[model samples]
Target: MNDKREVFYAKIMLFGEYSVICDSMGLTIPYAHFKGELSFINEDKYTDLEFAYESNRQLKKYSLYLQKLIDDGELIFEFDLSSFKKDIDKGLYFESSIPQGFGIGSSGALCAALYNEYGQNKIPNSRHISKKEILNLKKIFAQLESYFHGVSSGIDPLNCYLKHPIIIQGKADLSTVGIPRNKHDEKGAIFLINTGHAGMTEPLVKLFFEQCKQHSFYKSIRDEMIPFNNNCIKSLIKGETKEFFKNLRGLSKFLLKNMEPMIPETFKEIWNIGLDTSTYYLKLCGSGGGGFLLGFTEDLEKAKFELKKHNVELIPVYKNAKVIDTIKNI
Candidate 1:
């Protein structure tokens, strides 16, 4: 009943899943196939009445949480809490298609939708957004998104809010950049394999942190993943197909060896076939464990054929220079 709402698209991280944890370059983009928006539930219009009501209740709880943080001086920014509360009273819910716990940035989109609708003195999403503004927004968003997950980097909401391709050169260095576009003639593709379940980010992330405690494992991250991952990102943007896949193969192999727990149990055989036969190489979409597994192949059809026996289907996110589909997530 207030102002019109805006739909926030889902985010996908193409590179730097674990490397980002070590302050390496990370790349994330928006996916239009999945999206969310703040909406009010009307009896005649609301089809998922039960979930909508539940969402409203959650929003109410979130509003109170925000208020508490503000009052306690934990969060300094101002929000139109009164208006947000009023909307919740009217069955306000997030109308979204982004799958939760699938590493597609479901909470990130919701956070972006809320901040856009309620936050005061907001940085507008414009054509010329500066690095400083981006950093500031990430700082604020981290606090806001923490209500959903205990500790968030705020990168997920950052992607959903900016709705552009972001590249992180280091921990604090971030900027929007143009990615290589897919060429119609190119057959090579980057894709996603749905694991048919949600991934618990906490445990997998904990595992990564725990692994990092080991000298050899942590050394591999610094020596192996960081270089391979950064080069893959660089080669992709420069349209160097050969170099890109070279590093991609290294990155994929490293994950298979070290991050086994993150990969679903049933997917191991096909994952190896890609590595051995070169049909397609798979990597963790997010923290791993479950959700979507990112895959790359020279031929999409061949990859699909190889996966058919495993009962796995891929949603292509990129092909050559083009964006075929989108994701790593928020």
Candidate 2:
């Protein structure tokens, strides 16, 4: 059954969280630091027997779900489910480092691996994939990922599958984008602050949709959050640092005030501190009930100093020596 497949990496939604649902511009990039691949374990050679057993069990469950989708004619794509089941019987499972319940695309990476290995008439990865093809692929991924998120936008899997930076312009418009090159001596950085807890995206998103039922809440999102979010994406892509920071500050403030529930209670004070001092800005990475909180700071060292007592790890998305060296060449 050949269960081995190329690894699919996790993704970070750099901008546009809830706003993307309403057709605002969103930017996402593949985070190769964490990834997953489908593999079969030989019980004699595997050390973690319980983990292997559990993973195989989960994959069997997922296969059943896929079979149901196939039977109902709900899934538009074709895959060799018979072979997939054969592999599952052989202890096939996803081996991944991507943490679940984080804003990062854990399930999305799994869906991508499945589709990459099994999908019929698969969309080839290329710079030339058409808008229509991309949208169609997104729909397929959305349905596939629904097993995890309850509701799926499919953008996560799309980004993971393509392994490229994606800019979502609207509900159906997405394109590959090249991020602006970092300066060799850049002081600013993007980072993730671990909340030390996982978040369930379905509940958080459900709460958001329920809140949107209110006129004022819906209007505020339309009038303030969407505009700020869209502007931030635009400014960032254009490498307009001043404009980007200005819009980021506004977006950060809006989220702090309006999306309070999404932010972790323990981290709320730090989130506010960032806004109050202009030292840093914190925003929702994803559904944000308790996963990783994304941060932006003009000075990474200053942010670290301010956040040191919090006991949370700060993982820099940029500003690493290797990244700086790559930027220098670029």
Candidate 3:
């Protein structure tokens, strides 16, 4: 029972939200600030036995779900169910800081940790991993994570498992990519604006799929959003700051108009403020029912000043030089 795995971090989809469904390029990065791990509670030092008990109960339920999948031969990979059951009986639970339903890959981290610790014939994270292997891993994760999202692209868990930036060129093409380096003294930043509520990815994604059935909606996405999203990915990857911001603004505007249902009602005014003043631009962080809204600005201080009236937390994607250095090393 000593086979503990490293913590799995949450991931951010920097570009391509629903557009990815239509074969648009998407970029995702591992956000190490929020993470999760599998561990057992020490009942001796713990006062809250109820919390531990509940967590263990939840794990038992999840174990049953996995067992059902295995029994039905619906899962492609094998899991050490005996060991997993033993751990669950010993009160093993996923200890996580990543907020569930916050659009930050909480379920993805759990899936990654589970596969890493319990899956047999696991795929190792390395540069040498073939594209075929990566796609297989993604498929495995997509099936496992469907328990949470109803449907999944599997990119989130794949990114968490690899702990590397991933570029999804289309439905069938994905690869690890190095993010362009950030300047130390740069004032520009990408940030998350808390919406103060958790969002259900299933419903939002379902809504998106339904909307896509409409010819006009599908055309707008294919003609407008996909291009903007792809351009943003290309510009960001190339470190073309001016072009990146330009495409980002266009994407921001397009989302505000077409993706209105995804935006929280409370943040609508502030979202418009960014477009009206050009101080900052906002986009959906993930499925975006009510979780975090992603923001980009050339001047962090100025964006903060403009957003002061909104009672929301502003979390800079990269807060300091140390973070940049750490990412570079990764």
Alpha-carbon shift of residue 301 in model 2 (angstroms): 1.0
Residue-level lDDT of model 1, residues 188-270, one tens digit each, is 88788998899888777878889999999999999999899999889877768788889999998988888899899988877
Report the C-alpha displacement of residue 292, candidate 2, in angstroms. 0.6
Model 3 alpha-carbon drift over 4 Å, by segment: 43-51, 183-185, 319-324
lDDT string for model 3 (68-178, tens) is 998998878988999999989887887787887788898899899989998899999785677898899999999988887789889999989998888999778899887
Q: For residues 10-129, could you state the per-residue lDDT of candidate 2 as single tens digits?
A: 899988899887778898888888898887787344446677688899989999999999899887888889888998998888788888888999899989988888888899867667
Task: Give candidate 2's error at residue 161 in angstroms.
Answer: 0.5
lDDT of each: 0.84, 0.84, 0.85
Report the error of model 3 at residue 277, Å.
1.5
Backbone clashes in candidate 3 total: 0
- List the pairs of residues colliding in candidate 1: 12-327, 12-328, 13-327, 13-328, 105-330, 181-321, 181-322, 182-321, 182-322, 262-289
lDDT score at residue 10, model 2, on the 0-100 scale: 88
**Given candidate 2, what's the lDDT at residue 128?**
69
